[model samples]
Target: MRLTRRRLCSSAIALYCLFSLYAAYHVFFGRRRQAPATVVRGLRKGAAAARDRHGQAEQPPLEMEEWNPWEGDEKNEQQQRIKNRLQILNKSTKGKTHISVQIWSKAAIGLYLWEHIFEGLLDPTDVTAQWREGKSVVGRTHYSFITGPAVLPGYFTVDVNNVVLVLNGREKAKIFYATQWLLYVQNLVQIKKLEHLAVVLLGNEYCNNEWINPYLKRNGGFVELLFLVYDSPWVNDVDVFQWPLGVATYRNFPVVEVSWSLLHDERPYLCNFLGTVYENSSRQALMDILKQDGHDKLCWVSAREQWQPQETNESLRSYQEALLRSDLTLCPAGMNTECYRIYEACSSGSVPVVEDVMTTGSCGNTSVPRPTPLRLLKAMGAPFIFIQNWEELPAVLEKEKTLILQEKIERRKILLQWYQHFKSELKMKFTNIIESSFLTTNKP
Candidate 1:
């Protein structure tokens, strides 16, 4: 093999090129085990992180801010303040898979009206879709709140998902939206893309629906009865003669109010501000007091209306500080009993003084301590301080401010810890619901 220098150089270059080609082939065709291994490692890390962040019921209170209130200057006073902050509301993260929607009318009363009732629906972990069908089908869904597309029969024929459809309308749309939509979709409903038949059921009222009655007479063998309205007055006396959604509401179901929203399983919201709606409401009232007496500038949160629509929440840094510092936080049920306030109060370890006044004059017969709302403020775990009416506020809060602060701090600690551990589970639960609803219809 001894050759001239030029020949030797040529031979070496040839071998080098041949080896490079082989390496390239291996690179292209070789197994990609590394990629899969990387993915698995990531998942393991995520699971471990979740487990660590969320612990048993006895986990230490989850910390949101860097400086612990209790550990700050004036240790005794700071700890007392931290102890009193109520963390009764729950908190969860919003994931991807949120589908955008466009409605027909801008002036529709449905936005705020239905929003008040159905807010935080998108906060779930499920696959949720919104449609804007402009007044197409008359009396399809009774709620004028549903002035959107006529659900085009079968458009909603999916299983394991919560369907959120908001419409534009005028007048008192609440009563009619729930009642009418039930009737229209039952008859006119059909799956547009998929092939699933909607087995619609009225969870609230078990009226004898002849459509499902006869449909069941014929094709009942292939349907999953989905519940549209679920209330005792409706579900309890529901004529067995009629098809019901899901084999009767789950025994453990809380019978919370339902609409196109919140009825579905969803990821918990990142931020929920539970404030009293009245002039000088509970959150503000406490904030005002802290500012006046405590000289705490952190407690200044803008009024609910100060936030413009479509504005993403940016007040968390400050509001959280306020909650961490304040002696007491009120969660009186009025215009503010919705999800945001509950989550915010809970995550920040703020004790929410839950007042039982209705936010909307009429919230469909909903169960108290709803899952997301209760995730932070565990049910019956610590003192909930539930006030049945407005009159009792004086007597309950009459105790020394120190005593009141102590009571609230205890509750906040319990709730924030609970939310941290179970947050992932709670998220999965909500997402499953959306998946079920999106893929199925309210078939009878």
Candidate 2:
């Protein structure tokens, strides 16, 4: 190899260019190939320093929320009053009072009964409009005016439920207040030793309200019976209950396991014959109607609690008229109590053919009425009967028919008299209470 100065220089230049390209490649990609030991040492030192400085307070753990029972609806005075009134009425009556707190509320029913009683002694249309408004035999308004506290006064007014108080002087004054949450006589039962029912079915919603059956069963009433399909508050909708023989089974009670709504499930027609005013009380249930092929003046009608008058119908007037036209009035259960039919029938001077006319709800906790419809019927000389079924209906009706008119008149007299007596008793009680309250207030 001959070495020249220019050739030597070119070879040196080529060597430098190749070294530069190799350094560039190493700077971009080869750095990741292995970290410098100094860089790794610095990062480790920085992390240790940061941890040592901020370790004073520990972090808190996450927390959870709590639960409450009365979350949905707030407790109010109205509810309190209802509960209190029920307690008081139970105490004062020593567990007496029935038609169960006015059939809805003791106060409302008292007032209603008073109006009817007064009207029976007088006339609905005869009074002045203003007077009529106050003393009208019937009312149609519906309001949610809470029934417990405020004007109604709670239980210990030694107070009362389903009671009407005439605030003024005596019975001569006027009714000023009505109590709520009443049901006195409803507490009594013909308990026949019951345990748990197989299944309770309410033809209505299966619910807490449809608990009458359970209450009966628990109280040694229907010990051997199980529930079948029925509508009640607990279930979702209203429908007939049916169960397979395999799925449904239970022991039988010595007593009949009948629906609480009717006197007898099979013999509702017997209701017609048990009592009568101007009619025979000895006819077979449906035979009398079929025998006469029915009378135009004496008609039988069936209605539910929620009946509404239409454009052509008689409105609320028809109900009243129907009652007035008949010597007999038949009532059944729907929408809680007997509904308007009870008053409508009573107002028309008609005898109510009810299985449980003397019954009420369990809200009041009062003792059942002592002298029953039978006793009262005897007193009024009214032809009234109580039957367990339809088979005994017609003969009873036929026997009582001749005297139906007479008994109808007498029943009205008795109802009015009883209402007056109630007013008298209520007045006396109120006088004592007011006197006591006024005296007590003046004492201190």
Candidate 3:
């Protein structure tokens, strides 16, 4: 009986010790296993919260072993390097300025004039030498040319102080896309990324204000200046400047070769008109009047039904020769009283007989205090025959036939001098304005 009790006591003690060991194992080893699981769960919850705050979908958290604490630090260092480079570039450009010219390559006149103006303003010596040598002068300025939409985004990287956009408002179909691009560019201006914006607008024949006003108004404060072909009385904005003539003749024809002797020489034609003749236009009216008076025999007139955007090399040469040989060029009003013929005639010392009557269009504001036709040309002191009616042509023709060669030579000299002076004054004013308003070192 004693042996049985001792064995039973030993078995009970052994079972009690095993139970204590099992409890100890659970308290130590089991906690270590659960701790990693708990940590993983907490990390996932934090990642989920971060995603929610950012309005993004929750993504699986990277394993703890894969996490790199220095990743964000490396990204911050890269950004700092970029900022430093930009600051260095800005400092280097002090006392010097850069300008970006955004224009359509097809607007040949605008392209030519802007290039010429910049060349004269920045490097006149080179331009004069090239001209004297009978060589074409490619202008060198701190200016970059951007022609198409594809190049626009690349322009953002150009370190420029000012931007000049040349717009042809006559192209009705392209205005919508142009407006959108302008608006996008305006946003950059709003953020103070771009400094100044300017526009050289080629006014439509109809002088439709609708095509441009929306863009002007949408970014009113952003635009620094505007150069418009037609100056309406209603545009009292201080930023607007009048552009008197298109640069076509100076670009395509050799106006520099014209001399007093050439202009004074006797010619067969009394007047010339070389352009498309629109139905019901003043051109058609002028043609009819010339035909009735039998003046076609004395005038060089070539009329066509459709307007050609581009002139062939032969046609261009013929046009230039006609201007050189003629005493007067007929510039009848089409959509507007102003035409390229008037400017071309001036280049060749051929007097322009402009039809002064305003055509039917949505141009010039009559309500303005000083509403006048061809306000820009009048402002520039252009000497041209301005007649209200085509019926008065016979009287002018008679007067021209009566004038002596000396009188015609004097007139040609006066016209040539005036044209040269006009271009010089324009270059000076444009350079001064740019220096004062855009190229100044002062910044707010």
Candidate 4:
């Protein structure tokens, strides 16, 4: 009986010890397991309460790993700056103004200005495209482009207050059309039909623009601003701004998209010159020099006796292909040093070996030390090889031979980048100037 009682006491003691260990395990470890869930429930409740108090949903917590990798990238920074500037522009000029781009010239220079500067901001249309009435936030100021007088009726219905008349005053007959357009617009302004007027004039190659003075605001006329082409001495950045003679859009020279091949591809020809070679001109001399050095064989040279105003598709394609396949474009002075070829070469990442001598024109004063021939290009620091005489062409070509593929690629990249920057900077400046002058208050 005593032995049986001893065994029962020992079993009872073991059971008590086991129960204590189980209770301790639950107190220490099991509570830790439940604490996370309890804390999570409490946090969710707190978030809900905060939202209720504020009458808005709680913002999501930022992820620990989320960050912009391109924070230091120059291209990204430029894009951001442009985006910010655009935002400012949009916000400031919301609905205070309405403008129209009236392209009066069929000239490539006119098309170049319209396509590069205003086309992106305005509704895309040609000389024949009909106008529509609507609004969007894509551009700060609303603009409409028309090529002919047929679309004037649409502007009348929309009550467009501001007008940018793009005219080609390059020749005597062209100047007549420009004046007529001015008179028509002046009549509208006199009738209080239009609020503001600006002119984008492709001035004569020689820079004789005295005829348009009577229609300027300074002379008690309506036109407030003038964006003139060529190296006009009158580009004071106030009333008149120097506009670039961009690529020949009339010849269907496209906005060449920068590609790997355009920058790095092995071009066959060392240089190219495909245009009308005038008799006893610098171009004639250039042709002679090229042949004398037997560089004509290495370069793509195509010269015609008469200058054609218009280009055929086949001819234009061939010209563009030459620009693309050649490393350098030989830009001899035509009527002016600044030609469509210079800008076109830039589009193809081809360097322009320009004949930089000032032509006999009223463009600038020889008395003053101002850069006459290509003043705007010089000011903007165009990466072009400028020579006073065609005799320097042989030396330039000889130097070009020493540059390897990698060096050429780097140069092409710089040229393309610079050209794009120039266009964008001009676009922004043009927009800002218009807004400042036309709008009574930028804040809307």
Best of the candidates, lDDT = 4
Off by over 4 Å in 4: 1-107, 119-139, 152-158, 365-367, 440-444
Q: Could you give candidate 3's per-residue lDDT for residues 353-403 as a string of tens digits?
A: 988876666667677654557876777798888898898998899899998
* Model 3: lowest-lDDT 10 consecutive positions: 131-140
Superposition TM-score, candidate 4 onto the true structure: 0.75
Give the clashing residue pairs of candidate 4, or none.
none
Number of clashing pairs per prediction, in order: 72, 85, 0, 0
Q: By TM-score, how accurate is candidate 2? A: 0.31
Worst 10 residues of 2 by lDDT: 244-253
Estimate candidate 1's RMSD in Å: 22.0
lDDT (tens digit, per residue) of candidate 4 on 237-269: 889888888887766677678898999899999
TM-scores for every candidate against the unseen true structure: 0.34, 0.31, 0.66, 0.75
Q: Rank the candidates by lDDT, best first.
A: 4, 3, 1, 2
Q: State the local distance difference test value for candidate 2.
A: 0.33
TM-score of 1: 0.34
* Cα distance off (Å), candidate 1, residue 111: 17
Write model 1 residue lDDT over 1-444, tens digit each, in one string: 556888989999999999999987766555332333544554565567767777522322234112322343687777767666533221222332332122211222233222322222222222122443321111112122232334443344333122333221112453345335434433433433223233333322222233333333134432333323222212221222111121111111111222322212221221123233456655555445444543233233345635332322344344554555443455554332433444344445555556544343222334545322222233325344556554554454444233543454455556655544444433343234434443333344
| C-alpha lDDT score of every prediction, in listed order | 0.36, 0.33, 0.66, 0.78
